[model samples]
Structures are given as C-alpha cells and as structure tokens.
Target: MNTYSDLRLNLFCQSLLQSVGMNKENSLVVADSLIKANLEGVDSHGISRLPIYAKRFGDNRINIKPNIQMTKKSSSVLMVDGDNGLGHVVSYQAILNGIEMAKQNGVTAIAVKNSNHFGTASYFCQLACEQNLACIVLTNSPPGIAPWGGKDAFFGTNPIAFGFPTGNDQPVIIDLSTSVVARGKIILAAKQGNHIPDGWALDRDGHPTNDAEEALKGSLLPLGGAKGSALALAVEILTGLLTGAAFGPNVKNIYDNEESGKANVGHFFILMDIEKFMNLNTFFESIINLLNEMKEVPKIPGIDEIRYPGERRKRDKERRLQEGIQLPPSVEEELIKLAGQYNVEFPIPIPPLKANSIVSN
Candidate 1:
C-alpha cells in the first residue's frame, strides 16, 4: 500500500472512501484532492491525513453531509460557512464561485468561515492559473506558531499562495507557510523520527528544540523573525478575523482530538482576470523570457540548476504519475486499516518501496 501506480492509487482511494459510505462521486473528488498532494510531493498533507478524517468522522465531529451556505454573496466579494464539511470539498466549491466572479468583475475575493484544514493552499490558487487568471490565496489554521519574542502562539501558521500564468509552461505558483516550519512538517518529522533543522520551532519554554514531539507540543517559529510574524498577523485579519472565524489559540489541535470542536479554520481567495492587468500572452511571455535569460547567468560551482518555485513540484507530479507514489510504512499501514474497514479491494503496487523497507524518497 506504500507504493501504488497512479491509476491504482486513484482506484484505492475511491474504494476506501466508498466503504466509509461516501458515494462514488464524492469519493472521487476527495481522493483526487488528497492524492494530488502526494503527486506534488507534499506527502505531509497527502493521504497520510486519511486517519485524521476517519477519526473526525467516527466522533461525529464533522458533518459528513455539510449544508454549505452562503452568508454573503456579491459580484466581487463573497462569504461562506462550511458547516464543518470536508475541507477539500468545501474549498473547491468556494474557490469555483470566486473564479466565476472574477470572470464577471475582473477580480474577486471570497472568504469562508467554519472550515477545516484544506490541505495545500496551492491546490486552490493553481486553479486560477489554469483559467488564465492571477491568484492570491491565504488560509488561517489553528495557532501553532508564535510571533517573535512571544512565548504563546498568537497567529495561525498562515500560508500565502500565488499562481501566475506563464507561457508554454506550468503556471508560476508559489505556496509557502509563513512559519519557519509548517505544522505538517512537524507531523512528518514525528512520523519518520527525523530531527528538524535549526530555527524551525521552540519548546514550551521558548527555547529551540529539534525534538519533533516537543515541537508539536510547543510552537513553531516565524519566518523572517519579526517580519513573517507581522505578515501572519495580517493574514489572520484577511482570512480568520475577517470571516469571524476562530482566530488564535482557540483553534488548537483539530487533528488529534476527537473531543475537539470544529476547527472553524478560515481561508481567503483572490483572483484577478489576466486581461484586467495586461495582455495575458505578453505578460507570460515576458516572464518566461526573463527567466530563460536569468538561468544563463554564469554558474556558481555546487549550485544545482536554478529553477522556479513551482518547478520541482511540477516535475515530481509528472514523474510520479507514471512511476507511482511512495508513502512511509507507518502511513501505509494506517491506509490499509481504512481500506479493510471499508471492505474495499487494495490496489497493486507500482515502483514499490526499495528493499531497505523505508521510503526511498
């Protein structure tokens, strides 16, 4: 189960969700959203999160049949309430609404309250680029990162994602957590017994700690020291505060606590029609030409070929589609249990784990 070809993985996801009583249509959408993270090399937010979803569902903490409602809707701006539905499904619907608004008004801003973690922010922003639009998205999570010089966490480890259309190439999409390390990274380290590099987080005493367990109990560091903390504060206003959703420590540990309340996580989506700013083709062509020239700069020894922010993930997605995806053993085991509970057949492995029995990353 750790390794599965693209088609096989898709089928497995469908079967697993189906066993949980999700209809085939809903299962496929959820599966695609989760597996797309694996294909993009963001395993931290990939199918490994299935256990979390299962726990929530078992506890009745999530309304499997969410009543998605629009709190406010307009030509250029909108607001929604997720009613604690699955994050990916809610996010997809909201973002699609924003995309349509952009078509009419040349730009749109959509915010949603009372949602759960929606995996990667990039997943939503990239949609705009596919439609020849520029996108800027932000999401607010449970507070796990602290502002500089602060002992307690104040702002969510907010992420800012941007996707710009490019000429004859994948869109230039930049998605990053504002913290020195995203909580997902901490989860990854804990799973793999990997020690984090310096500056990622601190223990409860405000002291730096490489221990993944300690970091999880403590707080993540902010990016750029104070500057990133400031930006995170701004993001809180745009996404959480603006939407009247959970803001700081109140939104803690939605992943592990079955008794916990709905996360009430919030997200903001902004899309600008390319034609509103400039000729879409010209804008993209100029950027591509600039990058082409920049790459020709005299090489420095030891540096790998310079690539844009989204290049590596794009390449990985393409490679993995044919070769298959690899998950950690523990993650694989977790997935299998879900498959068994669902009474779904397991899929065949392709490019399975190496002989070492560890993720061959």
Candidate 2:
C-alpha cells in the first residue's frame, strides 16, 4: 500500500472542514482530532462525516464561529451558551476552560447548551490530562437507542468519557457510547456503501436489521443489554435534558436534514484538579500502577494482550505522524468536491494503508 503524508492529509482535511463553516483555527482542531481517530482506526469519526457537516453548516444549521462565552461562572461551576456553534470547536474550548477553572478551584463542572455534535469524546477528555487535570465529558446526541424492553427510542447515543493523568504509563482515556454502536456508525455505513451486521440495530418496528438506511430509520440496541440503556438516559439528563437543549425524543441532528431542525444540542464537561485531590505526581503514580497491573494480566482465550485504553491511539498517532494518513475512495471524492467548493487545490490522493500505519478502526 502507498503511504499518505500527514501534512498533505491534514491540510486537505482542514481546508475542507473550514470551507464548510468552522473557523480556520477551529476547523484545524477538528481536522486534527478527526485525523487522530482515523489514525487510531476509528474511521467513523474521521473525514467521512465532513460532507454531512459541510452541508449542515452551509445551510446555517451549525454555527461557524461560535462565541462559547460563559453565561454563569462560579468557583467550581460554569454554564455556557454554545450559540448553536460547532460541537467540536465549542466543546474543545469548553474543556480547556474547565481545566483552567479547576486550577483555581478543586474541581470544575461546566454545562453547555446550543452546541452540535462533537466527534470522539476521548479527544476532549484527553485534553484535561495533557494539562494535569482529571477530565470527564458528557454529551448527548439525537435519540437513536432504545430503553431496554421498550420499543421506542428514548436515549441519545449519550456518551461519557473519562481521562486520567499518569506518570510513565499513558494517560487513561475511555470514551464510549451507551449504544452498541454510535449513531455515527450508521452515518459511516451510509458513506462507505456498506451494510452493518444484524443485531447492531433495530428497525422502527423493533426488529433487527442490517441495512444502514433502515437502521437510520430505527433505534439502536443498547450496549451491555439494559445497563447501557440506563447509563444512556443518565447522560442525556445531564447533557441535554437539564441543559435546556432537546433531549431524548426531541433532540435532532443538524447534520442529516431538515429532520432535526435547528438543533441546539447540549454537552457537559468537568475537570478536577488532580493536585487538589492529591499530589499531582502521586496521582500519576497511582494511575500508572493501575495500568501496569492491567497490562500484566494474561490475555483471555481469544484476546490479545490487555492494552491501556488510549495506548493504541497514542502509538497510532506517533506512527501515522511519520507515515501519513489515508483517504478512502468515497472520502476522497467528497474532499475533491470540498476542494472545488473552496477553490483550493490538493495533492494527488494516496492509499490509506501503509507500512507503519494500519487503517484506523
């Protein structure tokens, strides 16, 4: 496979992301985060979503340069108005603000309203660890998952993420959707012209289906059976319900169509000062110990060695930076269109798979 260069890919991605509606700086941040997911083999959040975001943004559904200013601020809490801005851009700055606030207080809790979809939650949570803070992200998206035993969809993908700092061991960042698969999965399947495995989702009639188009018309199964459903609702309450944005059945996508008209999605971010809880160095050591213990465990019958939550991503980032990123045929086509729309020229496409870099999950 031919190697792709990160410089070219990043430039291409950023240009398109910005042309759609994101401010140049925010678009670059979004592009970098999306590319990080791709490098880590999480293609669903990568460039594939660009075209949809562009369409939504161009239509004035998602804001380009959101003022993300705080509406309420306290010693350890903040309330923000996203002003219908880009979720990624708003949430990224929100997390950074939370970290800074935590420095003055023992912890900081920030709730946001009027935001759109932010990519992987891990990206924002990891930002806290980069600055020696404990980070947690609560985000609610359009309803797509069913409450256990109930037929109708009642929960957003409703994701929660956690990040902790560590000394020698890598920072622990666990980002997950309460559903078996995120709603983004369906969007991605649509992009690749692929059909998902059955049992991943159910139709509007509550019957299992594999068609991405049909699943988009239906509800997704909760992860871990019922427990994930419970968590999904809890996250929705924090992110959407309480934040005054649409929640559960009311939330709609600003990305897809007129379907989710005027989406004002809400998100919550929290950052805890590690030093306030314990010595920063000591906290790192404890985290490192925990991760080290997990690493020593023998692989299960069919499992490989136990890896830390963000370890693979960190390694992938290092390798991909050297080897470059890849663009699939569909994504490449969209990027070409983006180039035309922005009146920009990009280098010839390169194959995604390469020597040091495996395609991101």
**Top candidate when judged by TM-score against the true structure:** 1
Would you list the C-alpha lDDT of every candidate in the order shown?
A: 0.80, 0.79
Please give, for residues 72-131, the per-residue lDDT of candidate 2 as tens digits. 466888888888887888887787777778998878889988888888888887778878
lDDT tens digits, residues 1-361, model 1? 3566656677787777666656677677778878888989998988888777776767777666778887546779888899987777788888788888898899988888888888888888777788888899898987777877887777889999999888555778899888977789789889878898888888888898989988887888988988999989899988888887788776646566633678888888888998888888789879899878887887789987888778888898887775678878878877777777767776656534442332323
Evaluated at residue 137, the lDDT of candidate 2 is: 90
Query: After aligning candidate 1 to the native by TM-score, how far in Å is the CA of 48 from where it should be?
Result: 0.4
What is residue 7's positional error in candidate 2, in angstroms?
2.3
Off by over 4 Å in 1: 351-361
Q: How many residue pairs clash in each candidate at the backbone level?
A: 0, 3
The residue pairs found clashing in candidate 1 are: none
